[model samples]
Target: MATSSRSASTPGWPVSGAQSRPPAAQGAGGWTWALTAPLLVFLAIAFLGPVLLMLARAVSDAELPSAWPQTAQLLRDWDGNGPPDDRLAAALGTEILAARRAGTLNRVANRLNYDLVGSRSLVYATGDALERGASVRGFADLARIDRRWINPAVWTAMRHAAGPRTSFYLLASVDRRLDGDGRIVQVEREQAVFVDILLRTFLISAVVALLCALLGYPVAYLLATLPSRWANPLLILVLLPFWTSALVRTTAWVVLLQTHGVLNEALIGMGLIETPLALIYNRLGVYIAMTHVLLPFLVLPLYGVMKGISAAEMRAATSLGAGPLTVFLRIYLPQTLPGLLAGMIIVFTLALGYYITPALVGGGADQMVSGSIAFYTNQSLNWGMAAALSLLLLVPLTLMLFAGRYLTKSVPV
Candidate 1:
């Protein structure tokens, strides 16, 4: 009984051996590994594996010019300043004839067409003539089939196509490309669209995150400070959005905000305005829709943090002669900042990749980075450019996430 009393009173002591449990790592090593393997495999197969593949595809060219040993060697030696010489052209013709006869002309054309616009039809036209036993003594027949065959730009594109991998897409994503002299140079100002779109993406996402912060702060404070019984109903209302489909919610907003929609009719009926407001299908619509959807992200985090703050601390500050503004700025705001930062980073990163909402609500000029990514991947069928754009957005988002995580840990609240 003395030993039992001592064991019961002793700090960190097990009452009895029968009541003991080993440290999980020490006792369940095999079980831990066995249970964790499926998750690791799932992550590898679904996320990490696809990310690595996208990274590789961003730099890889679909063309396999080297597969034609003689043609590749001939073109590699030719200066891309002007059109190829008759000998190199003859080699290209022979290879095209062989490729056409082997029923791979379409693949070859599709690859080259990515580099040069009319190359697909040019290949098909020339291959058709060659298959029909048309004479090709020089570049004359090839040029007649397609005027691009004699163009310097076509030679430049074809010269670069002689490799399995190239940085053409990555360079182009930044509005730079190789010149005839094989030097990296900026594309013309008229051709520089991605850079402006990228900047606009950052601007729009930042604005959306700021809007969420400003709006979510008040809602979260109310939820945290109110009596739990009172707040529960409002909290249910706030969470009602999640129960509905995101697409359905966005579509409803579109119907409500359109020119002849419910909002305008109500305003006009109430003598609020004579003219209908331009709200849907523009930057305004994007901001409103995204803010509504993502506001919960900011609110939930801020509410969690605010609930942890003691009312006694604020009362103590008041008793010590601090004004409401002073106590809030110094005490309350500082405590909630970690959660604010977390919520902003989450909303901003999500906004950077926003596609469906913007696509459905925003006009052409208001689309975000993911819109361009979808355009390139689905519409243009340019995987390299799409992957490059995706990487461009992901790198900065990852940096912000890590920096915010470090800040969150450092903040006391």
Candidate 2:
């Protein structure tokens, strides 16, 4: 009593009780890699790679040792707690004279002088002052000519210059030190700078963000409530600033807000004041220009959210005996919170990186982190310190963005 065999047309596969299926090549997962390959490649080149390279420079002590490997190796065994070792001193003396003969002492001096005030001239003058056949004794005699060389600070820095690499610049920015005796200590309160700059940057960014929200809210609401024909045109007007360069816009503000500029002239004509007010080159000017530049960032996000909300919600609240303001506050405004948060974050982050407007319009007191970064990178050529300051800015910017994303997710639609 053999069972009959199933035909090819059977519902199940040839094997009993097994379902028929397409080949693995036909599955959705087969296309996943092909679709996401471009994104993976883009992130590697455009994001992660550059960030790692930039961060490396913060701790990179490249020049002083890489060029003089023997001198660096000789100094490695010398305990920096006391005067330099005779062997280490002899090697340095030789290197210094050789570098001087090659007309390259200025390069080394320039590198060391980055964080140290007035060390360039000291190095240059010492190099020129060296006599033929002069040994380590002459270099050590530098203390007699300049009392500053007697301080342990310069020696501590020289010890750092003998390293494979170091975090000295990063530590110095935070007012911490790796002393000649190989101990870390807090610098004097007055000598600490990065912490103050960080606080100032945060405060300025927060203020500018708040001001943008205040100015943009009413404009966003009006744009959202107006008829499409009117709203579209107004939105174009609001977005007009994007068409112009940021530098041009900042410069325009400088011209308008100057002591005797159009604003003052108009105020004087209207008899609003007895004399021209101090509008430009101050914190007030920084706030005004930054807010103006950042307002559209606030408005666009908020307008998008507001436009999505149904007028019926407000109408329903009003019909239930809630006042207009109450309806907006309890119903409409709650829905717009996500957008407001998003706008605030964007504006704040942009303001934190602001250099041009603040530099051109802001007085000495109003300069932001970016201005400091530029000063170090360009004028002072202290790449390590510049990188550290930049990293300082990046931390908060990243945290704010993360918080914004979390807030957006937790919001109720």
Specify the highest-TM-score model's number. 1
Query: Candidate 1, residues 348-393: lDDT per residue as tens digits?
Result: 9888988889888899988777998999889877788899888888
Clashes of each: 0, 0
Off by over 4 Å in 1: 1-33, 66-87, 101-103, 135-147
Top candidate (lDDT): 1
TM-score of 2: 0.85
Error of 2 at 53 (Å): 1.6
RMSD of 1: 4.5
Residue 116 CA displacement from its true place in model 2, Å: 4.2
* Residue 71 shift from truth in candidate 1, angstroms: 3.4
